[model samples]
Every structure is written in C-alpha cells, then in structure tokens.
Target: MENTHGYIPSALLAGGIAGTSVDVALFPLDTVKTRLQSAQGFWKAGGFHGIYSGLGSAALGSAPTAALFFLTYESVKHFAGSETHWSPVVHMCAASSGEVGACLIRVPVEVVKQRAQANRYMSSLQVLKNTVAAEGFSGLYRGYISTVIREIPFSFIQFPVWEYLKKTWSEYQKSEVEPWQSSVCGAIAGCTAAGITTPLDVAKTRIMLAEKDSLLSRGSIRYALTVVHKEKGVRGFFSGILPRMMWISIGGAIFLGVYDKVKKTVSKYYLKKHDHIT
Candidate 1:
C-alpha cells in the first residue's frame, strides 16, 4: 500500500469529495436535526418542507471546510510520526487542529444555513445579507466558539476510535483496510461521538440561531445550557439526539469511506506515474 501520509493533493481532493457527498446526500436529515434542536418549535422551523433550505450555503462551504480539515489532519499525523503507543494522542491532536481549521469556514456557513433551515430568513443569501447588515460581518460567525467547542470534542472521540478500529481490523485481516471497512469503522465512531456530543451540538444551534441582542446570542456556552435546561429539563440536553446520531452515523460511513477510496486512488495514481518516470 502506498504511504499517503501528508499527500496534500490527495487529502484536499478526497476531503472535498467526501464532504460534498455526505452533506448533499444527507442534508434533509441535518435540516431535521437542526430544526429539532431549534428554540423555535419544529413546525415553526418549517418542518417537513424546504428541507434543503440551506443547500446553497452548505454546498459552497463543504468542500473548503473538509479540504482544509483533512489537509491539516494528515499533515499533523504525518509530521508527528506514527507510533502505536502515541497513536491516540496524535490522532486527537490532529483532529483537534483539523476542527479548528475547518470551523473557520464551517461557522459562517452554519450561521447562514441554520437560520435558513429555521425559516428565520427566506434564503441563504437573505440570511447573509441581513446578518451582515444588522450585525456586521462578524455576525456570520456568531457561534464560532460554540461550534469549535462542539467539533473538537466530537473529533477527539471519533478520530481515535476510527483509527483504532481500522488498525485492529487491518491487523486481524493481515492487510490494509478497504474503503468499506474504513467506512464501517467511521460509522461506529461517529455514532458514539454524536451521542456523547449532542448537548454541545444543541447549544451551538441555539447560539447560532439566537437573535443578535438576545442572551443566547452572546455565545455563552454556560448560559445556553442553562436556558435549554430551564425550557426542557434533562431531556433538553438531548434534543435531536436521534436525528443527530442517525445523520452522523450514515454520514460518517459515506464520508470516511469515500475519503479513503479517493485518497487511495489518487495516491496510487501518483505512485504509478512516479514509477513510470523513474
């Protein structure tokens, strides 16, 4: 197998493809999950209709966000030097870095997308326009801190689990894992991470969807949790857990699976071309 570590082109292309595939394929589920977690009731969030409300924003952002994430992730892992003893730590650090980079693009896209999904605006363009007009460009990043908080932990759990599962399976099989196997591992890891991080996700959604002058819009993670707890008790923390888990599980399979497949393909092609040149 080719050592695809730190392969910038492969990482960028694969991550972009994977991100677009997962987001586009499972967008409706994401909309459902977002609406479910909205302070606005589901029906008020335009439930069961316009499920693709924010497709434009999501589609535009997915490629860059995912590309930047995998680029950072692979580069970190490559430079860190792979050792079984330090694999989990390496993976966690890499994933955390990846999330931070990805969130630079992701938070703005999410701000527009979620508002559109919640029917607070007519379109992604309208959301962008109104947000910038009223709250300035920074408004597009209203939930930046909350998003990074949610994403870092999710990646912390998911990436290590995914790598461990792949390593174990590869060892058992006496070979590198196939894309499908990687996908299965990703699904399992994603489900676990999604369940554990649902509350953070809910808080992020509320913070992003809050009015500019509202308390939640101030982006206090503590305050967001307090409000949700006040509104729905313990259950509030787990709002949209089912859909979140479902979406991530399925999305993880496709995302990591496709990423492995594309990366492997591109890496092999490069190797072959180099061999021919030599």
Candidate 2:
C-alpha cells in the first residue's frame, strides 16, 4: 500500500477527475436540496418538481468547485505530510486551506446557481446578466461571508473524519475494501456535518437570494439571521435540516469515495509505468 503520509501528485490528479465526475452526476439532487433549503414553502409549491428546478445551473456550478476542492485537498495533504507531525491539527489546517481555495472560485458560481434555482423561470445566463446589471461584479458574491463560515467547519470536519473512517474500515476488511464502503462512510460524515451546520446554511442561502425590497435586502449576515428569527424563530433557521442532511450524506459519500478510488487508480497506473521505465 502507498504511504498515506507521502507527497502524491497522482492522487491529486485522480481526486480532481473523481470529484468533477461525481459532481456532474449528482448535481440534480444538489439542486433539489438547495431549493428545499432556500424556499419558504418548498414542498407545498410543486413538491419535487419545484425543488429540483434549475439543475443545469447546479451541474455547471458543482463540477469546477468539486474539482478544485479535491485537487487542492489532496495536494495540501501531501505537502503537509512533509512536516514532522501529522496530527489532527495539521489535517484540519490542510483541509481548511483546500476548502478556502475551492470556495474562492465557487462563491460566484454558487450565486449563479442559487439565483437560477430560486427563480425557476430564469436561465443561468439571465441570472448572471441581471446580477451584473443590478449589483455589478460584487453582486456575484452575494453570500460570501456565509459561504466561508459554512465551508471552514464543513471541510475541517469532512476531510479528517473521512480519512479516519476510511482507515478504520480498511483495517477491518479482509482485503482492500471497495469504493462503495468508503462512500458510505463519507456520506455518514457529510450528514453529520450538514446537520450540525444546517442553520448557517439556511441563513447564507436566504441572504444571498433575498429580493432587493425584502427585509433581507442588505444581504448582511445579521440581516439574514434576524429575518429567520422573526419569521420562524430559531427553528426557522433549520428549515430543511432533514432533507439537507440526507442529500449531503449521500452526496458526500459518493463524492469522497469516487475521489479516493480515482486517485488510487491513477497513482497505480503511473507508478507501474515509472517502474517499467526504470
């Protein structure tokens, strides 16, 4: 087995491929989850159809974001291993760095996707144009603060938890476990994290997508929290906690498992070629 503590460019390459592929495959579900999170009466509007609108925008947004996240994460992990210690703190820091890098690029795309999902009638381009015209370039980053808040903890928990679970599971297996097992563990970790962070996500989504005249007009984090508290109290902030957890768990599992498997496969192939050359 390859040492988990060494630099591995092949893993980063593989992780990128896996992450992008999984995002493309599972984006429709993500669109559904986001709609459910953002909408006030998501179920009453049109049931699943209402919730799953604008999947196309989600697909576009998720692909690049997932790719960058996995690439940055794997690369960071490899580089961090060069240090003397590989403690939990190191892992957390590495994961945070990766998440921050991914989110920087992802925030604009998320705005576009959220806008499209929030308004079923609008296309991706229409959302972009309207946002640019009204709010200018800054408008594209509507919920950046919330995004960062959500991601830092989310990534910090996600990476190390997944690594721990994968390692533990591998030890129990008679042979190398399949990718599906890793995916399952990833899903569990994702669900746990999503549940813990649901309130923050709700606040962020509302702030980003609120109308100009609404009480959330300023798009400030404080404004968003106040709106939710007034409208639905503290419970209001966790509106779609159940569904969000379910979807995130599933999505997380598939995403992480695919990333690990792809990276492992690529590394294996590359190593074999190098060995033959030597």
Candidate 3:
C-alpha cells in the first residue's frame, strides 16, 4: 500500500457518503427526536409520519453538509501536511473544520426539519413558506448560533474519540478488522459525544422549533434556554437524551464503519492503479 498522508481526501469522501446514508436511514428517528426535544407540554401527539415529516428537507440538506464536512477536513489536513500519528489536537482541528462546514450548510435545513417535526399539520413547503413569511430569509437560520455552539464541541469530541477508538481497535485485531468493528467503534464515539452535548442539542432544537409569533422569539438561543428552564427545569434540557444517544450511536456505527471500509478500498485501488501505471 502506498503510505502517504493524502488519505484525508479519501476519509472525507467516505465520511460524506457514509453520513448521508446514515442521515437518510435514521431520519425517521431524527424526526421523532426533534419532536421530543421541541415538545411544549406532556402530550406527545404525533405519529410516525408526524415525527418524520421533514425528512425530505433533511435529506436535501444533509447530503451537502456531509460532503462539505469531509471535503473541508481533508483540505485542512492537506494544507497542514502533517505526518505525525493523528493527535487529539489535530483531530480536534479537523473535526472542528468538518463540523463548522457541515453546520453552515445544515442550519437552515435543520430549521425546516424541526418545524416539520414539531407540527404534524405542517408540510415541508408549508413550513418553509411560513418561516420565510414570518422571519424572512434570515428566519431560516434561526438556531444557527446555537447549532454552531453545540456542533463545535460536539465534533471536537466525536471525531477524535471515534478516530482513537477505531485506531485502538484496529491495533488490537491481529488480522484485518471487518466493517462491523468499525461500526461498533463509530457507535461508541457517537453515543459518547451525544451524551456530552445533549443539553446544547436540546437548546438548539427548542430554538429552531419555537413558535414565531411568541413573545420569547424563536431566534434567541438565550430565550430558548430561558423558556425550557422555566417550563421543564434542568432535567428538561436532557429530555431526549436516551433516544438521541441510541439513535446517534447506531447511526454513527453504521456511518463510520461504511465510510472507513469504502475509503480503505478506494485508496488501495487507487494506489495499486498508480503503481501499475508507474
């Protein structure tokens, strides 16, 4: 195998492909999750479709975010051109870059998704129109500040933990590990990160899902926190922690496992082909 550190591109491409697949496959769960986070009272009225209503917009938004995340991370790695075994600092930087790129693309779509998830009656287009009318072009980005705040730390933990776990696991395996192993590692990483960031995640969800006309206002992250704290108390901030952790872990496992395997396969093939040409 041609051992060069240009593998970041391969990693990014693989991550994007894997992430998009995971997002689509688990979107129904995500819809439910958002609803759970954004719920106003004890009543959980929505059915499966109600919960998953905004999946279409999510799909559209997630694909690019996933792609951009990996692309940005890879570009950063290439620019840095470091050969040292990936350190926590390096992984943190890479993850931060990846997440920031993804979140920038994802925030508006996330707002749409949350609206669809929160209200069963609202169609994706309906929500989009309502948001535009109520809040204008800027309204679509309601929870962006919270999203960025949550995602930066979330990515910092998620990527490094995932890389470290996978590398550690790979080292333990005497022979080449299967994709399943990678999946397991990914799941662990996802769960760990989700647990750490659940409060912020809830805050972001509330900010996006809040009613536009309300005095509290939908755009203010502080307002969202204030509302949740007033209504639900500190425990409320962790409302969807269980489901979120489960879903994230499973999704992470599948995403990372597939991504790592695909990238490895592609890099191997590319290297072999290059040698043949040489």
Of the two candidates 1 and 2, the one with more favorable lDDT, higher being better, is 1
- Residue-level lDDT tens digits of model 3 in 1-278: 22443466676678668877988898877876776787563246375556568877877777678778877776665666433665667778977878777887889888888787777788888989998988899888787778988998888988878777766776787555678887888898899999989888988887777667774445566777777888899988887888899889999988888877877887787778778888
Error of 2 at 236 (Å): 1.0
- What are the candidates' C-alpha RMSDs? 1.2, 2.9, 2.6
- Per-residue error for 115 in candidate 1, Å, reads 0.2
Candidate 1: tens digits of C-alpha lDDT, residues 1-278: 34763389999999999999999999999999999999987888988899999999999999999999999999998888656599899999999999999999999999999999999448899988989999999999898999999999999999999999999999999999999999999999999999999999999999999988999999999999999999999999999999999999999999999999999998888878878888
Q: Which run of 10 residues does model 3 get worst, by summed lDDT? A: 1-10
Candidate 1 error regions (>4 Å): none
> How many backbone clashes are present in model 2?
1
Could you tell me the TM-score of candidate 3? 0.89
Q: How does model 2 score by TM-score? A: 0.86
Per-model lDDT: 0.93, 0.71, 0.78
Assess candidate 3 and give its lDDT.
0.78
- lDDT (C-alpha) at residue 167 in model 1: 92
* Model 1 poorest ten-residue lDDT run: 1-10
Backbone N/Cα/C clashes per model: 0, 1, 0
The parts of candidate 2 lying over 4 Å away from their true place are 1-13, 43-47, 50-52, 82-85, 174-177, 213-219
